[model samples]
Target: MEAAPPAPPRPWPAALAIGALAQTLFSWRVTIPHQLVFDEVHYVPAARALRALTAPANSEHPLIGKLLIAVGIQLFGDHPLGWRALSTVAGTAVVMGVFAILWLGTRQLRPAVVGALLTILNFTVFVQARIAMLDGFMAAFVVLGVAAMLWSMRAHGAAMWRRWIGAAVLLGLAVACKWTAAPYVAAAAGAFLVLRHRRADRWPGMNPAFAIGVLAGVSIATYFVTFAPAFFYAAEPLTWAQLVPFQLDMYRLQTQILPPHTYQSSWSTWPLDLRPIWYLYEPADGAQRGILMIGNPVVLWGGLIAVCACAIGWVRTRDTASGASAMLWLFSIAIWAAIPKSLGFFYYFYLSSIWLPIALAIAFDRFGRRLRYGDEAFVLLSAVLFVHFYPILAATALPGPQAFTRWTWFDSWR
Candidate 1:
């Protein structure tokens, strides 16, 4: 028997170009309907206030997401395009990040391409990218951080340390964007440490304890640095003495639900796609338009099944890649499920959405190795679902209210 030849590396330039083009085509619409939709109303105003150096706005969330939005506002002026510019960039980064992570983990071109396409076409990523919200930026950072961690698992010496530090900073910024990203960061760190332990021979000089300490120190420092402007520019700026209490206060505020929200959905229904947040729905500019924040059913449902299969495969074969993908997905879902809130939204599923494509990619990679055109069929079905739901996802004006009902397959979706 002959040793099998190594597979050629993926074409980086072509993959990135495809990812960027997909992101630009899907999310870079500057003047579609021309109004703030959903949480854009909250975050955009916070960004504007940040630009004006006004009192801290949207105090419940951390400052980095607004800061990014503010950068867009400062550079582009406060318009639809201006507020959403950074989100567009972040969404694009997410596509590239997904590609990198899948490629690094599976070491195959087809899985990487399929996973990135699935992520790019996912309604959650696409719709969120078109708006100014913390979730898209948070999701992007999480994906990038995880990708860096995945890369670090294969590197050694200086390159490995740099990748670890990069992962920490990115994950820290993710937490600064939204606390919901914390679990994914934690899981990535755990994965990193485990990989380092398993491959200890490859990293003879690496000290796991010192490396984890560095990751923690850098992550916390980066998170606090993101709040520097908030501390510096607030009307009643907090001194070093008050900064700790301010964070504590923010934590307290997060737990205190002051009002009920009609659009809130329980975590239990997320995987089933039972409830979707109606980000926008009204008559605008002589036409009826709406933005429904819902995951594409084909991807979401298929991804869920794929995740389960990955879990089973990991248990059966002890495959590190499958195990990592399964753990990341399950942990992301568990974080949301464990949130003791009666008002969680479907968009809270954003973290799991980041890992779902990876899980699907893993499943497809295994199946494609055995069956011809398996990955292609899966990708095609996902694209078809995305196209079918594009009208509602993009707030496209319908011919009539009756036409709107055509997209609403389930009563709960309406």
Candidate 2:
């Protein structure tokens, strides 16, 4: 029998600790080298363009992510700190959001803490957060929406409706940041429809037509409002007459076939992490430093098995937590396989990768107590791997010329 978790306590205390620890780690050496790394060249300049209201750069992606980056730049000026401050904040939000989502979904405390820890120890999330990137912002809002949706699903009456509205707004911001958020948005809407149709016993006035209409109208309005800033661009400013044409241009650019990249890996290979990207590996800060965007070997590899186990757990018990982990892992990766992009990269797996720790934590919550300290052991192993890989993952200066060789144990990773 699955062990019943004690009722969850207030989330604020845990959220505070997680936020503090994650913020400290994520902000460490973020200003090192004072130059753009990898995609920062594209995004940072695009953010600058947005801030200046000049000719737009990187128009293929939506504006909110860049606009958020621009806000950091506007406040802090165009330095490494300004460029990446919001990203660091977003990363911390992701960690706290994961904990809250787990708590709300499972009504369990242990799983929430473990999931947040694994998120902190995950190699890719850490690296991505410290950079000037859109994924971090999108991910933060995505989790917020998920947490809100979970709360809405579990609430009764008036509380349920308010949470639903909150979910819609957060999801709207997520979609405005990236189209990748669509699958989760769809999942939330689907859940609402099913619950209202067959399971909303405690909900009041939960008519299907009314609920669907509200969600659709609110989310769509939220998405469209993000584009309002585009109209204010000073150079060849976008006009009302050209709005539809602008969207078409963005679509055309996003779908156009591009030359394959050296670091590009197939979507199939992302879950196993068969390939990894070296965002930086050169002399920086007066020594050889590097940043490898890879998964934590212990947690990421174990997560695959845990995800399959979650599928089985759901089959046996129909536990919402188990089902959610399995479902999210499946959709997050599967969506990439179905996307029309001509090429894909390991980094694109960020969405899927975020689910691994959650899957593992749910497994621990449901079955791991058969072995004492099983969950703690798993977290320990993951943290060890994180430490071993930190030098490469954080662009920390290497100890010797041979250090890089040791870190790049896999020839393909080179």
Candidate 3:
């Protein structure tokens, strides 16, 4: 008979809606502890300062992140929901971006859905989204930039140029959110150059030099525009002449060794999940609550294997997408390792760990098709693990000390 008519393609609208709704539900919570948690203590006040056009409170990073947080506070008032609203939206956008990337890369809905789910359920993404931190905003922009670049690879002529511009803008905004995102911006530019070289024959009208210039120009312009308000609104109102030195001061602050931290971890231990920071832990109202900044073990451990597999696959087949992703992921790790900093924490891995879900998606797309129900099984296992770990992630009360102990799989985790 008639081969079932190819199962009638899944609607993009429906997939996007599902992904957005799931991420919103997962991240936006009304009952999330009202008291400022973790880095929220620093960022929330910075955002308030931004809203008031007062002196810059936290100059360690650029102002775009606080500006976004300020927008939330302006619209929603000063509270947890207000402080975290923009991050919640950014977190949802990240899921959408992952879906868009997989959809554009593989031209398949199943892989895109799986990738979105993986990102949505990532413990770091979930935790960061609920707090007023810069990571979620930077991550959202980074993913959008990556998706735009991937989409551009599959397009031609005007469509391709437009996508490149979009990628540059998003990546620039990412850097504006956090200077640490600079490497990702560089990675995107590098990927574009390589892709253009490989596809030179296909686009006869495209000028590589002009395209590179446009990308660089757009990125630099976007970064400066994002910083313009900072120069205007701060109490001192820094002039253009002073901006360069100001940024150097920020870099110095970042690299200098601060007072020792109890929860600090080396880059080496991040992949192994050796040390997790407890963002909050309080015993009140006859129950204990906490928000531990940790990765889901299943995704972290499994994604590591997937990244390795992608590397091997690239070596054997030279798959451009897999090779680009692997290189970017490795570059993220390498930059951190190369930096001479003694005060880094496990949270800094947020920039690198973004690739894990994408790598996992690639692995599933490439090999899972061979096994019966492989993708389905993998997604189910991740969801189950998310549920198993939700109590700790959400900071809900545990049954007792044993319940908390059971969740800590390793001594280092404890």
Candidate 4:
């Protein structure tokens, strides 16, 4: 019987474990040059104000994201490193959450593992994770909520109501993290409703109305949990009419952020990485102080190509999983690209970084069909690529020649 073929290997647990481990390793790089480089100036001050109930009502972003930074300050002494610690953890959580999503989406380990590796090696993910920003946290919550919704779809038990409720609550949490999470919530909810309607025969006694009620409850509860501070304290002593306008004012402020900065690129050029932001750069007495920017030329360029390929493949194949993943990927990209009023930067797309891995996975899946390279080879190539680019991604002090060598791929990336 050929020794039963070793049971064909379980990929989910292994993928989850590998993703977790990679995230942990990546978290260490976060501590190098332990200081704020980019948006820390705005957020750190806001976090401090949050602690004192003096945060500006005119502030652009919502309170929940800043509150998350405050939690890191509450524990870690309110330094740059302390505030960024929250971002680091959130970034790692995104990796774990993405792994869970891949596992649930495909119900196979090979794709899950490939997805995890792609995520770990992706330059955008590396940059966002190691910085002090809300994007990482937003990404984490969005991915987690999507994973929960996917799991709820497949779960069948006496406690199925609990799973559905949990998924809804997670979606609400994602919303509280960032308004961009709306797309994920909409996608997941629509999918769930369709699945419930189609599978009524399999799920006997399942009432869509009752399920919707559960979702509503979860959404309310989660929102209250995240914003309890804002509601209970009433930091601003304004009338009810004034409060709504104040919130609108904040939104308006964010829309008109015309900051004069070098890396302030338009939305059209973002997908091409035409204007990469310089997160950090300091001079060295010797020739050691090279650029400490994120975005590996290979992965960034590869992901762009892979995205086009995935789009075409999705169109040709019409695989539901491929279509759904591709649609969500493109939707997130389109949303970021279409934001007309905000002073957009490269990091804004960090929340949708999950698409990077999906693109790469699709690329690898395509490779798997024609090439002799097996799954193990895919893993090995991913590891090699990650390691080769690890130093620059981590901002390690490399000699000028060494840094220049890595820049050989694209002058625009400089």
- Prediction RMSDs, each to the true structure: 1.8, 2.7, 2.8, 3.9
Order the candidates by lDDT, highest first: 2, 1, 3, 4
Pick by TM-score: 3 or 4, better one? 3
lDDT of 2 by residue, 1-414 (tens): 998976658777877888899999999988875789999999999999999888768988888999999999999989999999999999988888889888887777789999999999988789889999888898998888888877777777888889888888888888888888867777777766654555545245667677767777777778878888888888777788887788789878878999978898899988887899988888887988888899888877899999999999989997767877888889888888888988888888887788898999999989788979999998898899888998898888887656778777688788
Model 1 Cα shift for residue 10 (angstroms): 3.5
lDDT string for model 3 (1-414, tens) is: 656546535648857686667665656453477778889889989999888988878888888999999999999889877888888788788888888877776777877877788887778878877888998899899889988878776678899889889989998899898887887766666776787677774334667688778877898789878877767675788789987898898898877778888888889889877898888777634677778789887778888888887888889988865776567678888988887787778888886777788888888777556877777787788889888888888878767655667677877776
Better of 1 and 2 by lDDT: 2
- Residues 222-268 of candidate 1 have per-residue lDDT tens digits of 99888788766659765788778888888877888656777777888
Best candidate, TM-score: 1
Rank by TM-score, descending?
A: 1, 2, 3, 4
Show model 2 residue runs off by greater than 4 Å: 1-7, 195-198, 201-204, 400-402
Measured with C-alpha atoms, the lDDT of residue 379 in candidate 3 is 79
lDDT for each residue of candidate 4 in 291-367, tens digit (9 for 90 to 100) = 33445445556667767766677688755566566667678877876665656776665655567676666666654
Candidate 1 vs candidate 3, TM-score winner:
1
> TM-scores, in order shown?
0.95, 0.95, 0.93, 0.83
Give the Å error, residue 79, model 2.
Answer: 0.6
CA lDDT of each prediction against the hidden true structure = 0.82, 0.85, 0.80, 0.66
